[model samples]
Target chain A: MADYYFKTRDLKVGYHGRALLENIRIDLEKGEILTLVGPNGAGKSTILKSITRQLEILGGRVAVGGKKLTELTYQELSRKMAVVLTDRVRPELMTGHDIVAAGRYPYTGRLGILSREDERKVEEAMELVNAGGLGKCLFTSLSDGQKQRLLLARAICQEPEILVLDEPTSFLDIRYKLELLDILRRMAKRQGITVVMSLHEIDLAGKISDKVLPVKAGCIYDYGTPEEILREDFIRELYGMDRGSFDPVFGSIELPRPGGEPETMVISACGRGIPVYRRLQKEGTPFIAGILYENDIDYQLARHLASRVIREKPFQEISVKVYEEAREAAFSCKKVYYTEIPWGTANARLRKLLEEVKGEAGIECTGLQEQLC
Target chain B: MTEYSFHYENVRRRGRYAFVFTVMILALLLMAVININTGPVKISLKEIAGILFAGQTDGTEYDIIWQIRMPRILMAAILGGALSLSGFLLQVFFHNPIAGPFILGISSGAKMVVALTMIFSLGSVGSMSSLAMIGAAFAGSLLSVGFVLLVSRRLHNMSALLVAGIMISYICSAVTEFVITFAEDSDIVNLHGWSQGSFSGMSFGNVRVCGVIIALAFLAAFLMSKPIGAYQLGEAYARSMGVNIRVFRVVLILLSSIFSACVTAFAGPISFVGIAVPQIVRLTLHTSRPLIVIPASFLGGAVFCMLSDLIARMAFAPLELSISTVTSVLGAPVVIWMLVHHCINS
Candidate 1:
């Protein structure tokens, strides 16, 4: 029974009898968060809609709690699954509390008057989402972040075994996006509820999801654990991004390197070169960086943005080969900017090298800030 | 913030509902008494009360009280409530506050069929039963609903849907006019007056039938408040919350049609009561919850229609105006104000 708490097989979905995606398969355990990530209009929403029964499935079946989704009565299905859609439901004259309480629909009596227990659950859900303070405010009057939280609160109050959302973070600010995902993580862990959602933030998706499904052109491209699927090549191919680069290790994105030959050499270490590298990238100046250890903090940016990087092994002294390369590169550049590089016994040679370059190259030392201004 | 305001809002909401209900009920009773006492041949309040409570005495006043004013007032109240409920349902269905039975051409559909039935039956049998007229009106209402459903499939715009509805209404009215011409010249005047809408000449039989049908519809609507409340969030969320959209939509359309059809069969195509009354009740109650709005709208509709009926009868003493004239004069401004407010807010 626990093998696949929610499963879909050979699923096909589309509008007006034409399939947009086909041959899809999903199998999930209880309490797992499965995230769908892809470029826009890649049928991510269509797949989510199909599994939640919002759109009719063109083929195949979804089974929840061992019952076929199509065969179960709506009431029975609702008790097991809940959804927060992207549709803007601007219900008039309803407070946030009223919107959340509407999630108790299946549990309430015929008239949908909430019981005392239902009220408690609603409060709990709001609290969990950090939306307890927003309960009395009108829904339409709330900010987009507040509305998204209230929607999550509403879905939480439903108390279903499975929850599905479509692009839940689209309208949220950075803080709210992180906070909402945090709440979802806690809910998934503590309540043992399975979550399926499409997210535009691949970095956050990779962080939160137990499994990641890549929605791509006309089909399910791949499905696996985030660690296996979130590679640099996969991210590049998945989005078909021509410009810019995605760093899988840091989950950071960098714009394509400036399109020109090397003009400047940046001398810095111990994370000091990051800002300088970014300024150079923005100024569209191709540059060379470092005789620093490979594991240095600045190495990450320099590796992506710099035309050439002079490197040494981590925790090792600057080698003769690296020093020769850095000195030559510095001389070949028009100007050189120096940033604070913390000196220690192992890497004291960098200061000597800098002094030698300044004398031979006839470049005067200037503060990095003065150079930027 | 959470602790203090939550309880305060609950109390405020409850208090507002209480206040609106009390005011509406009081107004309804006041208008009923006033309508009963003030007429072409005025009667004293004492005599009106006596006729209502005590057994009827065989006199003109007694006949006027029991036979004429009582049924007319009751019909206005019952059918008005029915119309408002129908409007509320249509607004919910279309997600537009201005949508109503008349605006959707549902009442015109019912009116057309009832007119045809009246002409054909009068020509062949010289008379038509009230039940037969209601049945014909209901059939016409469904026919218009079917066409609207077809239009809804093709056009998603609310105003476009209304344009289609208005076109359908004009076509139905034209056909009704054509049918009335086929009847004897004597019947043309009657048909024209009836089609213009009136609350006069309501019989006890019409009152009883509309009363039962409307009572049942009200009960059903009230019972379905849970789904209606969920539906206010829109179709996707409603379905996620266990509402079967296909079934719920059919039920909504059928109930709204029954309500408007009943009103049309009894009182011709009354305007704006369906759209205006529910909105007024919602604004007064300060909530859109179905449980509260449904009952309040019925009472609000009753009071509004009664007031309009009274004004229509007495505004030009012995020169009674059509009921639609009063309702439109009162209702159209509110609709316009709502449209402006809606535009600004959105």
Candidate 2:
């Protein structure tokens, strides 16, 4: 019974009268950002288009601001909501300013000439998106990232209660993607503009969205806070990832671990083993990584790239059982590589294990040769 | 700082628009004067001015100026403006620069229907009323536009749509030619000249009817400029801006059809004015904002048609060329250039 700024209940959406996705439910409060993340062709865009009324809804109810979606006229809906779509708009002889100014359609007079206030809004929107310098440039001449920023500016200037975007960062590079998400976050928090957008970048989605909707084939899979929905197993299942793993803590992805028996044992801690793990992964050498605390930063990546990762509990002294396990694994490998570890109470047993392994025939220590000081 | 620049850009754009409008109006007036003054019977500028402004209806020069030359000039200007506006609308509708009534076969369709009505009515009705001719032309225009829409639904490629339009034009022209060849000699004499396209022998009554139709359609198009501007961004964006796209599209087609049908009814499918004039106007104004482009296109079309009519009248001197022949020579090159330019840029 809570009053949601935007809500869709049991909605069915698709082309013609048939529903591609049904039984969909969504609830969003004012200023909240909701993101849809799914594999390609999972009907994310269809859900967006349906809510925007670009595609007809086959069943159920959609409401905005306590009004049924079907009851609001197009002009009313336009004033309440705006959208940034994936369609490539190549308007001839239009500058970036002109393109952004089109967002004032509902506010303009019959001839669509901008009033002084509307022009100011357009300018402010462009400034917000860092597109002020691009105002006079021909829209067709802009780079994909610049064009996307301008498009976002256009939607922002509409001053709607709800803003919808479908894959707004598809063509942007890393920097622009971060910049755009930052702008969206600012707009939602400062302006109280509700945002509903689909994103292909799950990492960005988890970082920026207040709520997350994971859509699967023909239905809404689940909806919750990003912390609840962005778990490693859920993301792996949502994307049907077979050859990789998702790290929920860092929102990082790692390719599948190498196959076969361990050829080398790498002993490192405090973020030193990541590069060795990656190189061995690239060379397709099956290796075991070990004596790492379970909570070490390197263990996160090591779990996905090493054939086996031997570990001890965080802040605990290495037990005899664990040390025995590490020693056995190290001796079984053809080669042993160890990095200098700061001697500590918890991992004092590792120093002994490494010294014993150094006496063996095939062992190497990095950073030992650079210790002139 | 950007606010000041935005204002400055707006002022500069307005100034450019003013300059273009002034030039188009001046050219239109000059063309009208040349069309009135230069013919086999050379009426001096002073005499032509007197004849036009002094209300002198007593002499042979007055008769020539008032009766033969005046109506032809007015028809050329009015129908030319209408044709160009029609082309601009079609371009907006199809999102293709090359889309126009003549190129899309709507004009040929109108020409075919008018010719059939002329032949059939020559025996029974003796002569067709201007209203009847426009009605027939409108019907033909809708038919061709309908077929184009159907084909466009299946073929999303620009070149393929144009090919379909050209094929429709060929079919209509073939039908008209077949109908013309079997007609009586007197009907052939009237149909042949009209089918070739000319501004000759236009009555003041034809001028009055077409003037009213074009003026009304022009007003309707002007009022719809806001939605048309939104539409230029593409359909989904336009709809998001609250334009009722289904209704807007239908009204656009209906208005464009009315304008082109009025032109074809009076002037018989004058070629290239529709496609060439809007493109020229957009290039000159350096904006396709529709609020300015619509009126500018109308004026550009009027000037272009008046110039083409002038050449048709005096180029051979008494062995006058068809208006279509002159327009084709001038307008076809613009089209070719547009295609080449589009290719290079894309």
Candidate 3:
């Protein structure tokens, strides 16, 4: 209990005193980034709001730095925790500088005026987020990406030991999303700021979070390192996603493979077959992809988008049974498209299968074209 | 290099605030002089100065300047500042630019109770004390504010909130009118004048009472500028910044109610100044940092009301228009302009 910088014990959180999620537990060392990933409206924000004391905790306890959360005055808590909320802040007539300077609320004097040192800190935070030029811009006029950056800068300047953000990347584009996560990562690792935030982008969450908590169905489904919690089966069940597949290794999502038997056979190696598989998937062509090593990058995607995948063990010669299976599948298809392959010894058997299928009646074989024509 | 730019921006902002305060103070002083000078009896500025500063009081000009015009001008300035500050607080509380004492029906609510007290007290006791009238008005303001809060909880739309406020204003005004219609003929004369809103018939005593209440409330509000600034970001952020929101909200309601109630108790329900002055101040200052906006709004409100009172008195000289008529004429356009400008921007 004392080892963790922030911990929640048997916490129940919800709205209006009704528990939406119960028996939740969280523990983090100083500077550890804990991300909450869940299906929409699965009580991720409820837990966050509870921890921040924005919403009252329905039951149990939250402690920070060994002090009970309920025991800390808002002033004491404010110095230790700052939040960037999902709520849109439309402060009239305030500049980006004014907005960021608000982060010094706890430290400022009676009137909240920024001193020279406070101004320097504001500027430094802005520069840290690459928002130095935005200081003069009106907050309402900035693009969503710019606004998100300024808000992050606002949180950064607060100098909190624990920073809580609710979907900080919701409004940002990919570029800003990556930039924001990178800043959060750097802040957590270098400055040792503990981060607790909910993210819609689970892939990005997995990359940046030290620990990922999957919240679902009124409780924490699992809480562990991203490597432990973000498995394909768990992610699928966590989101109740039946139509598509999530790739844990590459963090890629693929739509459900097209229905029906194979109409085309794709022969490829390495990563050459990815685009072909995607194109075929888009066209609703249930294709067979094969004669590749299990360790190949294409194999990862083929398993998702291909109707059937024929494969060889990594670093092993293509077995006779596998080649027979590939030839049979190729003959069954009307067209066989083979990408340009560097035929090493292990995959030399694939070249023989391609030759046999060439010039066969009703079995058309062609080199993969850019257009997939 | 970044530090240099930030320093420059900071200095520039300070300079802008200083320039605006200087301009508003000049306008306030100029308007006060003009309001005193341009009343029915043609008191010259030289005589006015002598009567006001040099204590040369022996003539009718002295009576008009000291007794009639001085109290009226002071009432306009004090109540104007109070009303504007009330509106500024409401705007911050609601996170809506259009929210104000008059628009939210808070002033009308205060007016209803004050009107009821006036008629009943006139028939029973004789005259109402300034404190009693303020107390009645404050109760009424809170009642109306409570209703508005209820409506706001159910309907989160900005237009719906405005509609609810307008409906509340209509209901309160109707009740006040119903009470006024049954009053004695003599009471009607007094009630009619006040119900329409005016700065006339003010005494130094009224001025002192209102001045003290407003000054104390203004000081309290100024002291709260730090939390108010935090709140401008929104409730969640404000709370995270260590503002005890429930307590802060109650205080905001109480202070704003005290302000509008004081105005309604004295000058009836002066429209438009509450909503318009703060908006104009924010635009002129180009920032809503409450520390700056609170004082500036107070001063701006003072200037706005003084100018409006001057117009009300001198517009058709000797016929004296109601203050609300002039303020609405001047202020409604500013509100419209703000709405249009806000729409285009957002």
Candidate 4:
């Protein structure tokens, strides 16, 4: 029981027990964050709703704190878990403070009047989400980000051991997205709350989730640690992405590279080549990038965007073999763009390669902005 | 800083409740006094106060006040309060402010059933029992509620639902008219005025029975304010907050039907008090919190109905209007205003 604080066995979930997704299993320890990432209509929200008891599970056994969810009454379940759903609520004449205070439903008396301690909890929850300033404003009048924070404050005030959210970051700008996920991460660590949520932003999911669940088709495509599950191939397969490539290390996705062969060459290092690659990709021109160490920041993106890549070992001197290959590729290209790749002693050979490429015909090396325009 | 603003809002909320409740209660008292004083006999205010407070009997005035005016005024207060509360419950259930027993055809259904029971009994036994009337009214309320629920399964739009309700109301009224047209002429003379709706001719027995039922139903509705408040956020959130949505919804419908049925059983069918009174109360209080709005709506309804009943009784002495006539004239404008205001804002 201590090994996994929350676990699901062969969970089957869907509307009307028709089983849109089946045979799902999850094992999560206390204080860990698990995220579901997938494309639209991929059953991510269904799984979250089923686990939180918002939707009835078609078939499964979910046990939280070693007690079966099916056996727990709503009152008991509410004390053990709280959920932030994606449904829009437009309650009339209610302030943000009143909305958050409603989270103490399980603890409040029959009339739901708040006690002194309950009020304190509401305040603390609002403060935790940085939404205390919005306490007096009508909920309907709040901006999208402020409303999301208020919702988080409400969930926090519930004081549950586990928190479940479905697309909590939807409709929020980047700042609010980061702020909301950061608050969730802090809650999980500081309060030992087990978090299970679905996010459309895969990059944020990969960054904050301790366990990543890839939901697609009709079942769990993959479920494991971020390092194991968030890979270039896995993301592409899971989302059926035909238009972009995902970078696992940076947790970012790039649109499909230009389709044709190399028409230009860019000599860059230490991430300077990334902007040039993006511009050329946007303009639909195929290009080559080279003379980059295997571990350089530019190589991370160039590997996906460049038609041809010349790479050498990391932390090693520029080898004559790779340098010759790069010089020949640069000479064959019609234009060469240089994007101020800083040179160091270990790669002193790049200067010689640049000088040699300058003597070639039909190939001109210039600054990236001037050459592109 | 947050604490300061929260406290400020709390103070403002309390102030609003105090002001609205005080104003409504005062209006209810004034209307009750005016209703008693301004009949055909024209009793003075001094006489009314004396008779009401000191139990002074002045023969004809005492007879009028004790036998007719007192019972009618109490019934107006009780049934009117019941109607408004029923409307508030229906609005919450349907998530539409325009939902009310009269507009939703619930009162018309009850009116039809009561009319049928009366005509059947008049032919057989020449009389109708109060219990039988109430029972028939309850059954009719449930029937109409059942129809609305059925139509609701196919129609999610609020205006479409109201249109269905209006159609149901027309059918019931038509059937009632058909029954009246075929009935004995003697019965039509008595049934005609009642069918049109009035607060006249109420006895102490009606005041007592309706008083008890409306009181109990109002108490039950008041107790349910917690769940009602949670439900205003919508069902999914309410369920997550530990409310049992299925049981809560059924109880809401049952309570609303009972309240409206009591009003129809006693007063035939009063229009617009259910929808207009609650909306006015909410607008005045500037809050939709069920805890505050339920009781405030009850008081507001009492004031609105008592005044409407007074106008129905004295606007053209010896040629009194139906209670619905006055209510429709006064309450329809408020309802229209709300609709226009809602459209503009939304």
Q: Could you tell which candidate, 2 or 4, scores higher by lDDT? A: 2
- Candidate 3 global Cα RMSD: 1.9
Number of the top-ranking candidate, with DockQ as the measure? 1
RMSD in angstroms, all models?
1.9, 1.8, 1.9, 2.1
In model 4, residue pairs whose N, Cα or C atoms come closer than 3 Å (at least 3 residues apart or on different chains), thus clashing, are none
lDDT of 3 by residue, B252-286 (tens): 99999999999999899999898899999998988
Q: Is the docking of candidate 1 incorrect, acceptable, medium or high quality?
A: medium
Q: Across residues B14-110, which tens digit of lDDT does each residue of candidate 4 receive?
A: 9989988888888888888788877889888888878989989778888899999999999898888999999999999999989999999999999
**Highest TM-score against the true fold, candidate:** 2
Worst 10 residues of 4 chain B by lDDT: B121-130
Tens-place lDDT digits, model 4, residues A215-277: 885655548998898888878888888877999888988888888878799898877788888
Runs in model 4 deviating more than 4 A are A1-3, A344-346, A368-373, B121-126
Whose TM-score is higher: candidate 1's or candidate 2's? Answer: 2
Between prediction 1 and prediction 2, which has the larger lDDT?
Answer: 2
Clashes of each: 0, 0, 0, 0
Q: After superposition, how far is residue A248 of candidate 2 from its true place, in Å?
A: 1.0
lDDT tens digits, residue span A1-373, model 1: 4479999888888888999988888898889999999999999888888888888999998899788889988888789888989999899888999999999999999889988899899988888888888888889899888898999999989899999999999899998899989988887899889999999988888899999999886756658998888898889989999888877768788999887778688888888888888998999989888876789889887877888888899988777787878878877877788887677888777888878776764654444855543
Q: After superposition, how far is residue B28 of candidate 2 from its true place, in Å?
A: 0.9
How do the residues A227-334 of candidate 3 rate in per-residue lDDT, one tens digit apiece?
998889999889999888999887878899999988799998878898889989999999999987899999999999998999988899999999999988998899
DockQ values for all predictions?
0.76, 0.73, 0.71, 0.69
Candidate 1 colliding pairs: none
CAPRI tier for the interface of model 4 = medium
